[model samples]
Target: MEISGSAFNSGLNAIQAGQRRVDQAATEIASNTLPQAPVETPPAQQVNPSPSGAANTQADLAESLVALNVGKTEVQAGAKVVETADEVLGTLIDTRA
Candidate 1:
């Protein structure tokens, strides 16, 4: 088995991508959870809260949470790949001595 620079580069890229994903998801979740001022409704019209709107927000929150978890897993896997590549390269160098 041979380990090369490409393997290291791929791992690094994966780690970077995963980190970006995690960051984006966290930002989204934060924004979604922020409190908003209540809007005043006219006395003549009764305002009914849309259940669908609430459901949509909940769905988005769920998706963001999932993305966050997936990103963490991706980073861990990438780190392992990089670690394995480094170990293999070190062993190869040691055998040459």
Candidate 2:
């Protein structure tokens, strides 16, 4: 029972952590998409921004996307842990009875 309780707690914690990661990645993706240029900036300047800045944004976006996928996987794993814990507890109970 104690072990199952611990596992359930661990699963819940993992699920929460994954949810946080998902939220952060989503926010980053939203903020990074199609950044707005200043109104006063010339059309030619807007067309050709600094190479380093553009590269950085692309890298950040890629990282965020990866984080999103990782978060999804974590959530799935956490759910499995919780399920297995529940099954173990059930088996123990049945055996004792």
Candidate 3:
């Protein structure tokens, strides 16, 4: 019994995708955890273009949460692909024996 090239390639791709997802999640977590720099305001300019620094922080937190969820989903899907590939290979080996 011989393994097809496509299956081998797919397994590699799945592993790479899973690693990428994990890396992305770590990066997002680190960046979100860092303290944000204080916004500068001039005494003469009373009006601010944005609502407030707090609002920006809230938005960043929301975006980070979304990214984390997406990253978790991607990693899970990739793991599944790799698991399926391993199972198929194992079955092939069993049959050969």
| Best of the candidates, TM-score | 1
Clashes of 1: 0
Off by over 4 Å in 2: 39-49
- Candidate with better lDDT, 1 vs 2: 2
Model 1 scores a TM of 0.85
Native-vs-model 3 lDDT?
A: 0.69
Flag regions of model 1 displaced more than 4 Å.
1-3, 40-49
Instruction: Say what the RMSD of model 1 is.
Output: 2.8
Window of ten residues with lowest summed lDDT in model 2: 34-43
Per-residue lDDT tens digits for candidate 2, residues 16-83, read 99999999999999999966774587766686565787789999999999999999999999999999
Top-down lDDT ranking:
2, 1, 3
> Going through the candidates in order, what is the number of backbone clashes in each?
0, 0, 0
lDDT score, candidate 1, position 19? 100
For residues 5-82, write the lDDT of model 1, one tens digit per residue.
887988999999999999999998997788877777777785665578678889999999999999999999899989
Q: lDDT (CA) for every model shown?
A: 0.87, 0.91, 0.69
Q: Candidate 3: misplaced stretches above 4 Å?
A: 1-5, 46-52
